[model samples]
Target: MKATTRKIRDADATKARILAAAKSEFARVGLGGARVDEIAERAQANKRMIYHYFGGKEDLFKVVLEEAYLDIRNAEQALALDHLSPREALETLVRFTWQYYLDNPEFITLVNSANLHRGRHLEGSERLRVASRRFVEMVRDILERGAGEGTFRTGVDPVQLNITIAAIGYYYLTNRFTGAVMFERDYMSEDALEQRLAFNIDTVMRLVLA
Candidate 1:
């Protein structure tokens, strides 16, 4: 049993590495351009190993997409905001959401690639849905608490609120290149990022506050 468990652990580690490497490759180039050999090299595994583990590139892409959503949702849930005041909870979430995008550009790139493909790759990702459901539940709990305290608007849709929060951060990172060219300034500088995070928090508060 111990040997069996050890083998299982090793397999799981190899699979995780493959997923991590694939995320990088897919982020760098979309589904059409990512190469299995490169991903194998990056993971220090063989293409046959990747195939044995995940079937093929498209299936691997789907799992990569699932993992991306899984990561953000997992991080958000780990904040445990139920203990905080409604305003404080939301602010923490806003700051976290913005900072997460800044810290994880690969996430934005992966999502953009998925969108470019019209999300056909992610069409029936039950794992992604389950992860997202937890986040929506967390948001709903926050909204309910805020409503009870008379600090937030009643009947506000949690899904829409979450989307708005994500949109505020996502659009900024995803469009930074164009934004810099348009504004003639670096939108990703420390000062600029601070300003943007502040704006997102204030905007979300205004939208949610009673």
Candidate 2:
């Protein structure tokens, strides 16, 4: 029994290692450029083991995309914005979204890769869509609460609002190089990032606030 248990634990660990390695591989080169041999080497596992775990390169790519989406959705769920006042919840959501993008830029790259594939990989991910609904519902609830309290304008489209908040932060970081050159400023600098953070908060809040 002990030996069986140990074997199961080892298998789980190996699978996790493969997944971690695969995520990095896919993020760096995307699906078209990513190769299985390199992923196996990085995971310290054989190609046979990777195939046993995930079937093929395309299957592995789909799993990676699902996991990435699930991770972001799980983080948003963890915020439990419902417990806070509407205004505070919106602020927290904006800040969390900004920080998540900043800390995990790999996610941005992975998503862009998926888009490049015309969302073919993501279309196979029912789990991610289910996970995403929780966030959508949360945003809708927050908007309703804010409207009820007369703290925000009524008839706001939660989806559009959510997109706006994410876009404001995502665009700034993702396009920082171009923005910096065009505006002649250091967007990644400590002071500049802080300024951007303040700007994101102020601009989002003012847009929604009544």
Clashing pairs in 1: none
Model 2, 1-210: lDDT tens digits are 999999999999989999999999999999989999999999999999999989999999998899998999999999989999999999999899888998998899898898899999888677887887878899999999999999999988888988898899888987999998899999999998888889999998888888
What candidate 1 gets wrong by more than 4 Å, as runs, is: none
Clashing pairs in 2: none
Error of 2 at 48 (Å): 0.7
TM-scores vs. true structure, each candidate: 0.95, 0.97
Task: Find the number of clashing residue pairs for candidate 1.
Answer: 0
Off by over 4 Å in 2: none
lDDT of each: 0.93, 0.91
Residue 131 lDDT in candidate 2: 82
**lDDT (tens digit, per residue) of candidate 1 on 1-210:** 999999999999999999999999999998999999999999999999999999999999999998898888999989999999988999999999988998898999898999999999877988888888888999999999999999998999999999899999998887899999998989989999999999999999999899
